[model samples]
Target: MTHRIALCGDLLDLTADPGWQVDAGPAVRFRPDSCLLIDEAGRVAGVEADAAAVDAWLGSAGQRVDCRGRLVTPGFVDTHVHAPQLDVIASFGTELLDWLNTYTFPAERKFADALEARRGAELFLDALLACGTTSAMVFPTVHKVSAEALFEAGEARGMRLLAGKVLMDRHAPEGLLDDVEQAERDCVDLIERWHGRSRLAYAVTPRFAATSTPEQLQMAGRLCAAYPGVYLQTHVAENRAEVRWMAELFPAARSYLDIYAGHGLVHDRSVFAHGIWLDDADRAVLRDARASIAFCPSSNMFIGSGLFDWGQAEAQGVAVHLGSDVGGGTALSQLRTMADGYKVLALQGQKLTAWKALYAATLGAASQLRLEHEIGSFRPGTLADLVVWDWAQGPVAQRRLEVARDLHERVFAWMTLGDERNVVATWVAGRERYRRPDATAIPQPAR
Candidate 1:
């Protein structure tokens, strides 16, 4: 059966610009009463402004979704999230290492049961849709079954998801540890089975430098070299204590980033999470390698991790993306992530504009993941993964939007005050995956 959807509304077309590196702000094109046509393959086929043209194009077959007053934008792309740690979100009072020991590792151990893994994947993915997140790069537990569970759930929903079985050889509890050789074998097998399957992709995840021994890191690097386009995700310089520990663990290396670089793990597809404490030399190396960083502001603030210097990172030419880092972070809503990010940068005497924040959650993050051509924007050939935001949903939000004069103010107000309650619906692959019960699209009058 063919599928088609005509979404007509105030659309936010976040087209990419070469000047984004310098400005970090997106060029948002707002097209009111515009109609976007999504074909059966879930790709944007055409965009028309005249209702007559849209009706003629539909020809009585397409499902016309009226979104007159709503704001439609590209679906969010979360660069770093731990699926199993959804159970541990908002745990109080602990920094990086201690938080892992007390809350994260223990929670992940439950994924050893395939049933629990599946259940957790379902819950996490469902929550993501509700929060207007259509895609994400997720970190599952050390268990192979946990990765499988996440992959299966994503596939069922036709979502673009990247996930992997975490490789941790030491420091973690025995239940979560894997021998280096066994870990390598498991990753290879998973890559063969799941990589490039549907919209699912595999990532080689080493649970940061602290837990992985030299041998394990070497194996991880080798796997990346062997597999083309398989992403490598890990932590780096997230906290002062963790950075100090990494320096002690690899004393011969010049810096923490050097440890991964020495093992051939620093490359274009690699995504380092929470680069909060990186020095100039470290940032230089990361920039030269063309690697990306997942700037997890919520997690940094939640776990008492230091602020990420966006100015420093941009100056160093580092590719930066946003992540909820849930559990360690606090909330999965990108709005909250933007709000927290605003607060984090404000304390540093810096500013994050609403355009930059939304771009980071959508196209900016997609570019870092090397998936901009497929998932980020409403470009004609891209996937129709989109979020419909009701700007006038609540009394407070309604009042704010009423008084707002320009796109910047409207977007800033939304980022500063919006939450999941503002998400009217979430669409993945042109299919309505989630819709708020009270949400209603403005109907197109008789034409």
Candidate 2:
């Protein structure tokens, strides 16, 4: 049976990287009255604005979803998050190292139980959907079962997800540690089982330099080399104290990033989270390698880590995308992360425009993951993963929007004030993955 959906609404899509420019006109394509057509194969068929053309396409068979009073955009993609740390979202009063020992590790240890891992996986993905995130690069625990559980859950939901069993062969609790040999076996098994399966992919996750031994890091690098397209995800220069400790651990290495570079892990597919303390040389290395950084502002602030220098990053030509870094970060919603990012940039006298934030959460992130053709944009043949955003329903936000005189101002207000409540619906692969229970789309009256 052929299935189709015609989503009519206010559509906004990006055509280019707007960078830090306040003016979004050159990069954005906005259609006030438009229909996004999704075909049976769950790819975008077309985007039509002509009334006659839309009617002809919809015919009498397609499901016409009325979104006249809403904003339609591609679903968010979170570059870095920990699926096992769902329970530790707001754990209080500890910096990066202590917090990991106190909250993150203990929480992840629960994933050793397959049933617990499955449950966590389901809940974590559901929360992400509710928060309007259709895709993410996730970190599961060291246990193979943890990665398996997340993969299974993501596969069932038809979500584009990248995840891997964490490699932590040293400097951690016994319960959360995997031997280097066993870790390699598990990673190979997972890659064969999950990578390129439906919308699922495997990432070689080392947690960070501090957790993995030299041998384990070497093994991680080898997996990236062996598996051609598998991704490499880890942490670097997130906190000053952590950086100091890492320097002590690898005394001969010129910089924290150099350790990964030496091991052959620096590449376009590598995504290092929280690069808050990296210098120009490190930025140059990342730029040259085409490795991107996942700037986790919320987690940085929440854990008392220092602010990331966005100006320096952009000046050096290193790509930077947003990550909720949930658990250490406050919320799963990328909007909140974007809002937090605005404050983080403000503190440094830099800026994060609304367009830039949206671009980062959607297309920019997907591009960084090398998945732009498949998941990010509304281009014909791209997957129909998208979100319907309700206009400000809350009193405060409604008032702000009412007073706003321009599209950019209104969008900026939405970014600053919006949360999950504004997400009326979320679609993944042309399926309604999540719809707010109390929400109802504004009907297109009498055609």
RMSD of each: 2.1, 1.6
TM-score of each: 0.96, 0.98
lDDT on C-alpha atoms for all candidate structures: 0.87, 0.90
Q: Taking the tens digit of each residue's C-alpha lDDT, what string does model 2 give over 1-447? A: 175778889888787788788886668777777999888888899999887887787677667788887889899999989998878889889999999999998998899999999999999999999999999999989999999999999999999999999999888998988888999999999999899999999999999988999999999989999998999999999999999999999998999999999899999999999899888899999999999999999999999999998778978999999999988899999999999999999998988899999999988998889998987778888999999997686899999999999888988998999989899889998888898988754443223
Q: Compute the lDDT for candidate 1.
A: 0.87
Which stretches of candidate 2 lie above 4 Å from their native place? 442-447
lDDT score, candidate 1, position 412: 83
Once model 2 is optimally superposed onto the true structure by TM-score, how far is the C-alpha of residue 410 displaced, in angstroms? 0.8
